[model samples]
Target chain A: MLSIVKRILGQMKNDKRSLGLLLFAPLLVLTLLFFILSDSSYVPKLAVYDMSEKFVAELENHATVSEETEKPEAADYLEDNEIDALIWSDSAGTHIELLEKNSKSAVALEAIQDTNKALQPTQKELIIDYVYESTGDNQLDSLSFVFLGVISFFFVFILSGMSFVRERFGQTLERMLMTPIRRIDVIGGYTLGYGLLAAVQSVVIILYAVYVLQLQVEGSVALCTLVMILMAFSAVSVGALVSIFANNELQLVQFIPVIIIPQIFFSGLIPIDTIPFGLGNLCYLTPIYYGCTALEMIMIQGKGVVEIWPWLAGSVVFIGVLFLANVTALKKYRRL
Target chain B: MKIEVCEVNKSFKQQQVLNQISLTIAGGRIFCLLGASGSGKTTLLRIMMGAIPADGGSVTVGGIAVPNRQLLAEMGYMPQNEALYEELSAWENLKFFAGLQRQSRKTFAADAEALLEIVDMAACKNKLIRDCSGGMKKRISLAVALIHKPKLLVLDEPTVGVDPVLRRKIWLYLRQLRNEGTTIVVTTHVMDEVTQCDDAALLRNGHIIARDTVKNLIAQTPDGNIEELFFIDNQSEAEAPLC
Candidate 1:
């Protein structure tokens, strides 16, 4: 074991560039996410034309409302989506013609709803008009977290797995095997090394999505990081195991859709509950299911580690199984 | 210590690679397994190195059975493939192998340099292995195999692709090691290399068709050359097996 540790340290020393990339790549991505995602305030520009004081006040309360002196100016504003909703009253029971510039129609829809409630006391049936999406819900932006979780796991798993496969293909694995090293030593060394890298990556991505990109993360940052690390471990182990079945780089790449896509389907990115029961059971077997579940609990529900331990435990077990599988698979070459 | 193989046989699915092969190698002697490309010489070496188990019979090395961990530590194996990491320098590769063998740091640096010098690669020690030529990579791999200083050295086609001058230098080093009581077992298809061995095992179709000193094998054959004896044995085996 001492020799194994020393060998692992030596490998790290030799491949310093890979080590640096593993540590700092995620930090750089997280910083970019921070700058791009944070401060996403939806200040919808509104245009009001020939509207009563009461109607204008209702629109102003819900959005950044502006008054248009000419019909052409209001038409231009509507065409450009400068005004999310326009209120123009000329005896047609105070018509509230809402114009949406952006597809995120929830805020504009909410503004229309608020205006209708205020007009209700006057016994006037305000006509609500929309240029697009008549029955669209205003909760679409809330789904970004699910996609973020999927993307994070995808990149981490592929990078970790490919790096490991490269080692095997390059014959470095054979060199390590020729030593007096145990099979367990190889698996443990790779897991610890890549696990450290993936953990840092997960933290950077999560923190960037939360603090930098300003995504809606209602849960504890620490819990999120913990869940991310667990997810990273699952990816790293799966990647290592997959490399065993692959003879070369091309074969390793062929596994992406077969191995990774199935995980995405089960990872709660899409509603797997709506699928058939037989197929849904298959989703439960995917590591991404548990990872995405834990991520959702921590990010959306603000769940603590105690609440998310079962999913975390599932990921840990999956990682452990994959690691053991890798060690056993290596026996095809060296028995010990 | 003596290494003995008793009627070992191995097959890959339906294709038999080795058949009823037996030999005994004494310590402080140089033994070469000479054969053609598909003669199973490397397979025999792997069995001795405990990398693969034989389908039939058993092998005992240093009084212990094959695949024993303690025995494995006392034996060094250099595989046919270049196994060092291409991204790392030759020095870095040696450091890693030495560490794995649990060599002391104080001796590791000087010993690694000496081994590189022996391989005529001391000048390119710090260059990335990926940048080195095929011969340089092979030399570094040989140095790594010798890092542990094992009593028994098993080399599988180590001199292939190496220039004639360098090959001779490597053989000279092996001879020096043999003088120091290190038992060397090398596999090669080159007919000329068989003359250098104290004892040679000529394998054909995975069987030890002839096992004796080069002079004895030559005297037994119609032609005096070791290559002629190998061809005669191989041709007879091919015809008999088909019939």
Candidate 2:
């Protein structure tokens, strides 16, 4: 196992492309998402017609408020997306027409509601609290924890899968098996090798997400990093296990849809209960789901290791099962 | 160790690959298995290496049954394909396999250098296998198999992509290893390469058509042409020219 680990590290040392893909690819995507997901830079355009001066003044602080003489014209502006939303008062409360399909609609609605609450003063402020509340300033800030788990697992999965496929196709696997090394050693060695790099990768990425990208972490950052490292080990084992069914790199890639995409979908990206039927239960089977769930508990809910050990155990069980499966799969190549 | 394969049988799905095949190879000699493509040469080699199980019969290296991990420690094998770590340099690849064979790092450092020299790849020892030419990769792979100086060396089509000059050098190295009591089994379709071996087995379909010493086999064929032995019937498919 140590020899295989040494070989993996040696190969990785010489493979600049794989190293670059494994280390920097997730960072690049997250950085791009950092800029795109943060809503602080966006200023919503609001068109007001027949609204009181006090409410418009408060709304002005939250948005770029435009005054209009005609309600139809303001509605037309919202239709054309010239304004994110239009506000007017009639007999039945105040009407706010928001442009559909524009992401700016939610921002506009939140700004209007805040402005209304501020101006009314006595209109009771709803102090609703959740069991687990989002602490991020924006959606991405909260989702960044999940991204850290998903992205790290994604890249590691691809790297390990492609590398294993290369070994099989290049026949290096056959050569390795020809040695006196136990089949389990090959699986263990890969897990350790890639798992070591995954630990480093998790540290760098979690630190980058927490310190560099300023992703809010309410719980211990070390706990989150541990979860990510486990996810990566699971990714390595899963990748090797998946590669057994693949004949080439392209076939390995073809598995991404079947093996990876489902995991991403079920990794709490889309609300599981919202999914039709009991398909959401499939999330329990994906390693990334447990990883993302554990990371969410740590970074967002401020939950510690005690609260998340089951999730971590889920990843551990994944690694163990897949490791055995990989060992058994090698029976097709060499038995013993 | 004396390698023995007794009445081995192997099949894939409905198609049979090896059928009632048996052969004995004594230690300290170069034995060659000669056959055309798909003639079960690779399958036979794989079964001998304990890579794949035989449906019937048995293979034993020395006195131990096949697939014994400790027994494999005394054997080195080179598959037909260049099964090497392309991302690693030749030296690094050697170090990895040598480490698996449990060769101490200090001893491997010297043994690797000498093996690289034998394969005439000392200068390119640090070159990555992917960057090396086909012939260079073959030489490095050959070096990798010899890195541990195993008691039994199994090579499958080791000289396919190697240049003639380097081929002669590798043959000489095998003979030298044989003299040092290494049992070597090589499989190749190349007829002239058979002359380098002490004994040759001609496999047709899944059966051994002939097995004899190089001189005796050549003496049996008319015109001293080994190709004539394989071409006794015109109905045989067109084959790569055999010298």
Query: Which predicted model would earn the best TM-score?
Result: 2
Give the poorly placed runs of model 2, Cα more than 4 Å off. A46-81, A86-102, A111-122, A131-136, A271-276, B234-243
Model 1 off-target regions past 4 Å? A1-149, A167-170, B220-224, B233-243
**Model 1 lDDT tens row, A1-336:** 444445445555667776676556655654554445444467666677777778778767777877778654445667686556666667556555554434545667667677778778777766886432213121322444455556666666776677677767765676577667788987887777767767777777776666655666656887877877887877878888887788787888899989988877787766887777668788768888887888777666667888988988998888888888888988976887
lDDT score of residue A47 within candidate 2? 87
Measured against the native two-chain assembly using Cα atoms, what DockQ does each of the candidate structures obtain, in the order listed? 0.40, 0.75
Worst 10 residues of 2 chain B by lDDT: B234-243
Q: Given the true complex, what DockQ would model 1 score? A: 0.40
Clashing pairs in 1: A34-A212, A34-A213, A37-A213, A38-A213, A38-A214, A81-A101
Best by lDDT: 2
Best by DockQ: 2
**TM-score for every candidate vs. truth?**
0.78, 0.90
- The superposed Cα distance between candidate 1 and the true structure at residue B240, in angstroms, equals 17
In model 1 chain A, where is the ten-residue run with the lowest total lDDT? Answer: A132-141
